[model samples]
Target: MFALVDCNNFYASCERLFRPDLQGRPIVVLSNNDGCVVARSAEAKRLGIKMAVPLFQVQEQIDRENVAVFSSNYALYGDISARVMTILEQEAPAVEVYSIDEAFLDLSGLAPHFSLVEYGLQIKRRVYQYTGIHVSVGIAPTKTLAKLANHAAKQYPATQGVVDLSDPQRQRRLLGLMPLREVWGVGRRLSRRLEQQGVTTALALADCSPAWIRSHYSVTLERTVRELNGQPCMELEACPPPRQQILCSRSFSHRITEYNDMRSAIAQYSARAAEKLREQNHLARVVTVFIRTNPHSQHERFYSNSASRILGVPSADSRRLTATALRLLKSIWQPGHRYMKAGLMLSDLYLPGHFQPSLFEAPESPAAMRLMQTVDNINHSGLGQVRFAGELLSSGWQMQRNHLSPAYTTRWDQLPVVRA
Candidate 1:
């Protein structure tokens, strides 16, 4: 058996964690640069605020409804997510961190030892008690069904945030009732294709032959079908596969036409991407920098260009990445355009020992690597207090985060305060 636990309205919940007064209020978390609605609380959903709706488009409705608006507070959310995952790690034998707000647990022999429903409820209670975050738990014979059960747990209030579909009959009933789109791995396009073929429900897709599904759709879809039918095609991944590329980029709060501002933005992005590479223990051989004018602007002539640099040797050192990114920025930058966005991408990633350098070139020295590690440690511990000189964000070059919440869990100065 497998169980999936998912945080409910994660970003909104994180915002409400420190501001208890905001509980039960409509909340909307905007995307980078306050571009659009990325997350909405249940109350916001009830107000018909659709996901990805531009902030300007819903300003009137949000103001009239008195919605608690927030920019994406990722530092707070990431810290909260880590705390929740830590609590979960203690409860489950093995856990797969599915995403920032979801995890799957392996319940192999435990199912026969105890009631899965009770176990799910226990996890929910413990997590909430420890982190003040409500989570929905779903248990089933397979991961895919476990995800469906989780969906039901969150969709229906009567479940009390815990649902068990371990029974075959219960699985079939839920599958029948669930639309194909709700099934894991099935998106709107695939759901419509399946519905047109008369496989309109989760059970209908499950009933289709695995080979037939594979031939008609793809192998991944076939695995989903099998998993839906109580067969576990996927196992708990303790360590997720490494990414081939790391990108750090964001649209500026406002456009800039200066060279120094664009260079500053690219340098910051490069440092961020390199930091991610080090976090994953990978070294990148190729660095690509890109700059672009606002595509949506009618007054400005849209210009976009990108340049790539091959490192002398693969390295995860931040200084090297930032320097390369700045040089690349210089090549593609045109002075006249109002640059709206700039970014860095580090590709050709490989594990530290896996890359064999040429005779003339060598990887980063052990001492240099240690120095980088020390710097990373300091920056991580201090929420980016230590950094390269080029990393400073030029005035007005940063993303628009007008409604950002304090980094309550990660930053000491931003810790929550209480009064009696």
Candidate 2:
């Protein structure tokens, strides 16, 4: 058996976690740089705040509705997510973190007499009890069905946020009423194609022959169909695959037209990308940088350009990455174009000690690795931050966020204060 636990309105919930007065309020969380609406609370949805809509497009509506808006507070969200996952790891037999807002559990090892529905309810209760974040629990025979059950848990309150589809009969009943697009892996385009082919419901797609599905669509879709039919085609991944590439980019809060500003932004982004590369214990051989004008600006012409350079040696050193990125930025720098975004991508990554160095190229020394490790430890400990000389102190090129919330849980200085 499989169980999926998903946080309810994750970002918006995080914002309201410490603010009980916000209960039933219309709240929306904006994406990084305050560019768009990424998460909306139940009240916000009722107010017609669409997901991914640009903040500018809905600014008037938000004000008129007196909607509460918050910029993405990643530090707070990550901390809360960790707390929720930690609770799950202790509550379940085996666990797989499917996303920041979702996790799956293995319940096959439980005693046959144990009640799946009751256990799912317990998970839902404990997560809320400990973290003040509500979650929906779905239990099914297969992971795909578990995902569907989770959707049902969220859609209908009658379930009380717990749904179990272990019985084949119950699975059929739910799938018969579910649209093709609601199936775990079926996307919009795929759902449209399946609808045209007369597979309008999840049950219809599930009834198709696996062989025929494989020949018509991809092996992935075939697996989805098999899983929908109560066959476990996908197993829990205890350890997720390592990322092949790391890219860090952000839309600037304001337009920039100067060369120095672009250099500053790329320098900081490179340092960030290198930090991630080292976090994964990998080194990158290729460095790419890009800058662009705002695509949504009506009066300005859209412009974007990118440049990449291969490193002489794979290295995760921030100094080296920053230098390479600055050089790339110099090559692509355009004068008076009003660049609104800049970023860096590190690719062709290799785990440390996994590959041989070229005859003329020298690998990063052991001391260098230890240095980066120490820097990371210091930064993570919240004691202080380490930076390269090339990175500018004043982040003028950085994306400005006007409505950012305090990092209540992560930053010592930002903690909320209560007084009599």
Candidate 3:
């Protein structure tokens, strides 16, 4: 059996964790720059304020409805997500962290020891008790069905956020009732295409001939069909596989035109990507730097360029990556155009001990490895206070988070205040 555990209105819930007064009230979390609605509480959803709607368009409604609005507080959300994932890992024998707000647990072997539904309830309760965040759990024989059960748990309050679909009849009935778009593998475009083929429901898609589905849509769709039919095509992955590439990029809070600022942004991104590479114990042989002017600014001329370099020798050191990224940025950086975004990608990743050695270049020194590890440890412990000299103290290219809430969980100064 597989169980999907998903946080309920995760961003809004994180905001409400510090502001308990917002409970049972309409709340919405905005995207970066307070651009659009990225998350909404149940009350906000009830008011029919859809996700991704521009904030300006709904300001009147938000005021009239007295909805609590917050900017994305990723630091708080990340810390809370880590706590929730830790609890899941402690309770479940194996857990696959699907996203920041969701995970899949392998519960097949534990079914014989206890009631799965009861176990799910225990997990849900423990998570709430520990984190002050509510979660919905859905258990089924396959990941796809588990996803559907989770949807039902969230959609219907009578389920109380726990649903088990081990029974074939119940699984079939739920699948029959759900729209094609609600299935785990189906997206908007695929849902529209499937609808054109007269497969408008999960059950309808599952009932289609596997051969025909494969011939038309692809093997992935066929696998979804089988999984929907109660076969376990996807299994819980206890450990995430090493990433083949690591990308670090972000849109700037304001457009930047200076070469130094662009170099600073790319340096920062490269350093971040290199840290990720070291965390996964991988070496990247290639680094790509990309820069772009805002396309949305129609009055200004648009410009975008990317440059890639293959390192003489693969290394996970942030200093080397940052240097290479800065060099590449110098090549692509254009004057006069305001750059809206810049990024770095570390690719051609290889395991530490498995890569081919360069004949001309010397192997990375043990001292350098220790230094990198020390820097990483210090930064991790200090919440990313350490930085390379190439990084700017205050780059204009920082993300626009105008309405961001304090990092209550991660920052000492922003810790929740307790009233006497």
Off-target runs (Cα >4 Å) in candidate 3 are none
Q: Global lDDT of each model?
A: 0.90, 0.89, 0.89
Looking at candidate 1, the ten consecutive residues that score lowest on lDDT are: 387-396
* All candidates: CA RMSD (Å): 1.3, 1.6, 1.5
- lDDT string, candidate 3, 244-289, tens digits: 8999988777888787777777778888898899999988999998
Compared with the true structure, model 1 gives a TM-score of 0.97
Query: What clash count goes with each model?
Result: 0, 0, 1
Clashing pairs in model 1, backbone N/Cα/C closer than 3 A = none
Leading candidate by TM-score: 1
Per-residue C-alpha lDDT of model 1 across residues 1-420, encoded as one tens digit per residue: 899999999999999988979978999999999999999999999999999999999999998999999999998899899999999999988999999999999888987788888999999999999999999999998999999999999988999999999899999999999998899889999888988899999999989999999998999999999999898999999899999899888888888888878877887787788888988999999999888998998988999999998887899988888888888888888888988888889999888888888899977888878988898898877756676777675655878899999988777888888989
Give a tens-digit lDDT track for model 2, residues 1-420.
Answer: 999999999999999987878888899999877889999999999887899999999999999988999988888999999999999999877889999999999888673868888998889889999999999998998999999999999999999999999889999999998999899889999999888899999999999998999999999999999999999998998777779999999878778887877777788888889898887789999999999998888998888999999987799988788888988888988797998888899999998777687898788888888888888899899989987766774467776568888999998899998879
RMSD of 3: 1.5
